[model samples]
Target: MAELRRENQKTTSELKETQKRLRQLTQTIRELEEENSILRAQALKLKEDTANRDLSFSRELQQMKEQLQEKSCHVSLSSYTHATVPTPTLSPAAKPPTPPDPGNSPIPQPSPTSPTLTPRDSPSDTHSLPAAQPLNTEPNPDRPAKPEAQVVLLMDSNGKYLDTKRLFPGLITRAKRCQNRGQAMELLRQDTLGNPQHIVVHTGTNDLHTLHRETAEAMTKMAKRASREFPDSRVVISTLLPRTDTPPHVIHEINMEISRSCAALPNIHLAHHTNIGTWDLHDGLHLNKVGVRAFAKTLKDVTLDRNPNSLAHTAAPPRNYRPPRYQQERQSNTASHLPAAPRPPAACYTLPSCPTQPQKTPPPSPMDDLRLCDEQSHPSPTH
Candidate 1:
């Protein structure tokens, strides 16, 4: 009974020890959760601070950029002002004029901010400044520019030259008043014709009234000569604008000749007469503003296209329109290039005009006729 009582007391003490250990473990878990919550709060606060710092830094950078732009603008304005100020071109004998008294003069005394330009400067020098440009001197970064096309245009008075501006940019005009295909042909014979990328021959309308076919042939010849003169330049021939003097059939025939002649020429382009519509006319030949517009539009289409290899040139037809002198010279040149042929012997020819001189033929006269009659009357005495 004594041993059983001791065993019960030992079991009671062991249960009390286990209960104390369980309470201590619960208190340690509660402390760990409080520490975890505090760490999470600190991490969120750090992220917010980083975001705020980035925003403030970005604002400061933008402000700095604005300030730099303002400074650059001011510098450019000052430089432009200095460049435009007239530099006095004074002669050795010229003296500076005396300044007026500030108190006596009605005009206010000049401020000392900037030096005044002198009146002694010549008008030419003042007008022709070194670098006079607008105040905003900085070139635009976004502007994509191209060099202007430099072209020389030769046209007759009937040509509406202003209409060409719509298509031909940077055009230099050489318009002749009261000119025909013949006159335009004469201009091509000049020795020094400048080399241009585009050479426009807008003529033949004046001569199309009576010489429509001939004028068309002459125009083709003109295109050939222009090509020869400016070997590097492409000759663009604009067709005769709408005119009442020539029938549509004549116009069609002329256009056909132009196409045929210009086909072989690699540089020649024919601007066909298109129905860009018609304009009113008094003499049935002169092209008014509307007719000119139509012609210019046709020209625009021709120039935009670079290929002109389809047009074939007729060797014999184009030659007909060439000047007589040119034809003779060409013949001589061709003959010179040929193989030398044997000449006829001097002894073989008997005529006076031959290589060997001979007797001259007598001239017939009325005196010879009277002598013949006398001989007949005296024939009986002689017998």
Candidate 2:
């Protein structure tokens, strides 16, 4: 019993020692946790401080930008004022006046040598007033290059849908008679844009053969890059041609998504080239002769109609417009019957209202007369 009690006592003591050690371990763990929390708090504080500093720097940068803009605006305003002040005087001075004979025709004769246009003016604006006009306040992202001159086509092997350059003079084409879609896109991206007016992209037929997952993204990137890089150019993205490898439904969904993405981008035109007769199995991926002609004509017509440089730019005037002959005759008779006042320039004169009519002053309004009498009595004091 004594031996058993001693063994129990020893065991109890050992248990107490373990308990004490456990208590110490618990304290150590608590200290470690507290230290970790302190470290975390310090890290959080450091992050907040860094963020605050970054925010302050951004704010300062924004303020500087605003100030720079204001300064630039003021400078531009001053330059514009200085530039405009002497234009009227300079123009008349430059044109050495040789008074025409009194009996000479009023039709102006062109000088022998063509005059050089001002650096700021385009050939289209040669007839504009010689006086310096205020520059466009808004930035012109694209130069005023002629649409035909700037239009370019990037086509894959299947681009045989059209020979657009042939129909539209000065339009550029980079594709050979045949090329791969992936390679064409890479080449197109790598090629210098060189201030084009329009970029017509026809790719992705081969993407159907390749089953590339990145096709949509690649196409989207191409459109976006073209838009960003050539702000002045019109971007035209054509739908993929039918391929046996890819299901029609799959092609359609992909095309619809791509069209949506392209449509969302500014200055992008989504064109459909789903002509049934275009594709062939023997030719691998090429348009038939008939398809080629039809597609070409359609593209030519669409692009020409959209082109700013085309003669068809302005719609034909209404065919129904007829002269108001009876009314004009009556007015002429009435005018002849009455004493003639004065005739204004034909260009300035409009029908129904004569610009030469003297605006006769009213006999007198009592209020106006009173105001005039007061003004005469108390003229503004001048320094």
Candidate 3:
């Protein structure tokens, strides 16, 4: 009986120990389940935050694209005007009167009856027109005409003042606010009219703030189009300026996209920063004074170095051209020697000398009369 009781006690102790172990395991499993739930909640929150960030970035990019487009349009228009406008040459002896700076006040228009003067006889002129005489007229036979160059600025409203102050200290910059795509288009149009040879584009900050994709697309398109439109002109597309306060991942993604876009464009050049890692920001968008100066100097050097041949091309007149002075003098001498040109005779009633047959007028052909009537008349087939 004693042996049987001892064996029973041993079995009881083993059973109690096993039960305790099982209970501990159950508690451990419950704690694991709670941890998994917390982790899942955190994952969901992260996903939602990422989604919100993406949406915000998209909106900002769209707004920026719109602004860039507007600015581009304006620039195009300005460039076109510059190309078409006739540039007048000034003579040494007949210098044009120093017109008052138009910046201080409105320019006055000359009256139609204002004293008319020829190019040679004007009192204000200090330079004389080149003579049509032989090339031997040069005082220094070995010297060639020195080439002249001018610098012009191209920018939208946000950072244009920096360009004006740094690059073109003598001249005033006409700033066009790039509020949307329409405005950017207008700016481009103006720039085209103006024919700026070197363009520095500083944009994309507002787009980041707005998270607009269209802004990037528009900017890329503009850079591409500018390459075609202004083949002679160089287009410098700046990298998206840094925003340090934003999340590291977001900033990295935005900059990566910008760099990618710039790389895709064949004609667009990326501006180099001294410190690539340093985030330079003005209100999280524009560059500060030091940044602007660095950018301007880089641009200036690039522009000056790129076009060495242009200097010689712009300096010399065409081989076939004759000087205005010779033409003028020849005309004056002819006038002095010859009788005044005869005036047209007044209408008088006179009989026809001989009867002439009326010639048959040719009828207009179908090809000659073909004209564009309406948009619908020439509808393009859908692809």
Which candidate achieves the best TM-score against the true structure? Answer: 1
TM-scores for all predictions: 0.40, 0.37, 0.34
lDDT of 1 by residue, 1-383 (tens): 99998898888888788888888888888998899899899988998999999999999999999999999998877566444333545556655567678889998766999677676754645543345444444555555664333465667765645545556755654434437777666766434234557767777777776674697678788888877776766678887665544455676778788888878887888787555323334345665565565556656668667543423421122222333343457679989999778888987886666476787989868999999898888875543
Pairs in steric clash, model 1: 262-311, 263-311, 263-312, 264-311, 264-312, 264-313
- Model 3: lDDT to the true structure: 0.58
- Specify the poorest-scoring 10-residue window by lDDT in model 1: 313-322
TM-score of candidate 2 relative to the true fold: 0.37
The lDDT of each candidate is 0.66, 0.65, 0.58
Estimate, for each residue in 1-383, the C-alpha lDDT of model 2 and write its tens digit: 99999999999999999999999999999999999999999999999999999999999999999999999999898666444232433455465456577568586665669675675766644444465665545534453543333666777655654555576766554444324455545545424546666667777777764665556666787778777777776777776765544555676777787887777788777766454321333253566665566456545555554642343332232355332444457678999899988887897765685568788887887998999999999999999
A best-first ranking of the candidates according to their lDDT comes to 1, 2, 3
Worst 10 residues of 2 by lDDT: 308-317
Clashes of each: 6, 1, 75
